[model samples]
Target: MSQDRAAGGRMGDSSLLRRLNHAAALSAFLEADSLTLRELRAVVGVSRPTAEDLLSELLAEGRVEETAPPRQPSEARSAGRPARYFRFRAESGYVSGLDIGAHKAMAVVTDLRGRTLATHRVELDPDLPAPERLQAAVSAARSTWTQAHLRAADITGIACGVTGALRAAEGVHDVREGPFGSSLAPYSLPGFTEIDVAAELSTRLGQPVAVANDVKLAALAEHWKGAAQDHRDIVYMFAGHRAGAGVLIDGQVHQGRHGAAGEIGVFPMLGWETAVARLHARGAVLAAEQGIEPGREGELVITSAARQDPESLAALIAFTEALARGAAVLALAVDPEVIVLGGGMSRGGAIIAEPFRRELAKLTLVPLEVITSAMGADSVALGAARMALDTVITDLLTVPGS
Candidate 1:
């Protein structure tokens, strides 16, 4: 019995080594696009025999394929005819990114490399039932995938960005349901109270779907591919339908104990809720309710009106000040290098940026910058994609022999 147990341990050790070798070989091929046996051996730091065995495993798994002889990077590395090269089958899997809001639902399909394969957007009827609205989001994903000439089975994972407070233990809570007097986001319908939105999307899409706060996701997008890319630590102020923030410290998003770390807008002293209330009192909210559109429309009206009327300009400045005041608190706490003004109000161009900077300068002695978000509205969805992409890659990396 002792001999049998020892034999089993040896088998397990061999299996583990083979799995590690397989992962290394596959990763090296992906980084180099394609690799010959000799090059792969050098890249994975494996012997020729081990590399050959790993390649055979991958080929059998349909993950690597031999293609036409591409030009090699170096010559005379080996003393034989050029060996056949193998490339990763990047098409073996797909991923998706989704942005869900009361106003619009958008979906983007991407290959394993996170390249945008296709995208689709649909205006939603906010008055619709929650399940129907969610289905619309799922349909949009399907449409995008179909446009990419891919099927449902091809999608390995999906990530969604939604307008709400996402708690780890309880899932998401839409801001509209909170005690705030003002409707900050374009939250048209009554929202789900305590639903596992990620699980819901995953069930509907037939793939793993992860969910995150839209503003938080937007900040991530900024860090990953937008203006905040230059800085490792950033405070991204999301001024869209609602006023909030997404903080990145040391290149990772900081989610507090309850995922409410950046919910500064809820403070009555900061004037986020009051700012919108004041704007609504000035007839901006009326325009939105009167079928003018949601999100950016009210801001545009405010922007254009501010240029001509003193009241509009004063209101805008007051709102901007409130936004800056909230940001000052975060800046003092995190001391980030840059503060990115993102979300709906950011689309106001210099109109929003100037006032925010002026107000922030008055409140803090910190040497910080206030810059407009270069990512615009697409930040959340793209950031969702990036999050999803990172997750899928990590998941793949963890799988034995992947």
Candidate 2:
């Protein structure tokens, strides 16, 4: 009996080692883009035979593919035949990211490497019912995947960004009704407090869906491919139709125990609650003068401010001051390397930057570098895609047969 138990233990140990080697080899292929057999062996710290076996397994699973090596320069060519190379099959699977907001539902489809393949946007009424709003977001995602000429079965993961705080319980997130929830009240039906956004989206999409606050996702997008890529610690501020913030500490999003780590705008004393009201009031007048819909007021205000329209510039400054107050509180608490301004208003970042910095400086002990988002309106959706890609990769690395 003791011998039998020892044999079982040995088998378990060997299985664990094999799994580890498989994961390591796949990780190397992901990071290096492509690798030769010799390079894979060195990177994964495995024997030649083990490396070949790993490659064969991944190739059979469609997770890897052979690629032609780059042509060698005439002088650099040393051998009669070139070594073969293998690469992660980024095209093997795809994932989607979605941003569901008061005014628009946007979706982005990306490959395993997080390359955007297609995108779709659907305009929405702020007063639309919650169920219809969610349906619209799903439709946008489906449209984007179709635009990429891919089937729903090809999507390995999906993620969504919404307006309110998400409380996680047993791997599921429930949208908590709070200040942000009140802001979303116009779009929500009765019993909004009991809604499970992640579960809803997952069921609709026929796959597991990850969900988080939209502002937090925007911060992730900025860090992944936008302004704060060079900085590990960042504070991301959303300064368009509404005010919100996202914090990254040590290169990870700092979601508090309840996932409200950067919800400074919730505090009434911070004045973020009324910040966009200033822009809206000014934008209303500007829109009327230009004979446009009130929805375009925000853009008109920014454009007018750019031309140095005194009234419009004043409104922009007032909005900036109110926004900076909330940002200063976050900055004092987190001391991030940079504060990234994003959202719809960031399109006029140049006009908003100076006044925002001036106000922030007055409230903080040290000056902080402030930059605008490079991702613009697509940041939240892009970040959502990153979240979905992470899920897919995690599953790929852990499952025994995957």
Candidate 3:
């Protein structure tokens, strides 16, 4: 991940050297309006020979590929030299991104450039036990394989985004706590075991699995592909049956020390807990009218609200306003450049953004930009697949015989 970089700053002596050494390799592959070795060398104040070496290294790593445009040889060069361009490999090996939500799991197969090729979704019994639920996610991935028209070998890696705090491998409570304290203590997920899920999925996929909070993954997707692209710091908030937020600082997702940094739902608001309960209770009542059991685990009380049934829409607006109140608190503290609204209920970003922006303006003096996520419900899944791709690419770089 990139660190906190000062934009538009004058290049320092050593910094210029480093940038020149790396720019040809990485920037060349990325899409740009126009680029050339001469231009890159000029930016770094390096000699032509040094620039040639940098380009050579990039070509050796297969990071950049040269292409010749389809044109008459006479048109190809105005002064004498032929024009050759470079592009990042769009058809590189595939990555599988997965999102394990409370009631559903979705997986998307994408290329190195993050273009989706195929997708798969599955409805799971939210009331079922944890291991069984994980197995359902595995099944979803396997089904996606066929849908994508790719063999298992074509899948380079898998990334998983879940809804809980994941402890480091050493922290599992496999033993009793000592006089000081042991790493192994039971971590709870209402219907799943975190360790078990990670272990089972890793084993089933035959590759390492990265499990992170779902909202964090959503924030990552926004940072990678949504309105947050211009801002290095951002906060992604979702208002639904459950409310949550994700933080991104310096282009990296901030999970905090314990992975609970963005669980904004637990943060106290003005009678927020009560209001949320009432909202869910209202949803349950409505679901009952449709013959859905009030206590069913997968029952979407909030989904029903966001569908714009007159009374439900009214309730949802109140919730969005209340959510804005919570966001105001975050804005005052972090002061990020933008806040992205996401999740199933956030479909009407225009409606929600207008009211939330109005409410936020009343609370803070700082200029805050609010926008909706382009990835929407697919954010976590895309992020997960990216995680998987990272594992495979990283191994290919480091392992002796990958």
Between prediction 1 and prediction 2, the one with superior lDDT is 2
Candidate No. with top TM-score = 2
TM-score of each: 0.83, 0.90, 0.72
Candidate 2 Cα errors over 4 Å, as ranges: 1-12, 165-172, 178-194, 307-310, 399-402
Give the candidate number with the greatest lDDT. 2
The residue pairs found clashing in candidate 3 are: 96-385, 97-385, 158-388, 172-184, 173-184, 173-185
Give the runs in model 1 whose Cα sits over 4 Å from its true position: 1-12, 30-36, 66-87, 167-189, 280-296, 399-402
Provide C-alpha RMSD values for all models, in order: 5.1, 4.1, 7.3
Alpha-carbon shift of residue 388 in model 2 (angstroms): 0.7
- In candidate 1, position 401 carries an lDDT of 39
Q: Lowest lDDT 10-mer window, candidate 3?
A: 1-10
Q: lDDT by residue for model 1 over 1-402, one digit each (tens)?
A: 332234345666666666666677778867877888888888777667877888898889888899777764676366777578888887878888888886778888878766778888988766666787788889999999899999898888778888773534354344344445553333333455445576688888876687777888889989887888889899988766557787899877787766666767767788788776665555455455566654454475566565676666766777778889989999989899999998877778777888899889888886688788888556767888888777776766674632
lDDT of 1 at 307: 65
Clashes of each: 3, 0, 6
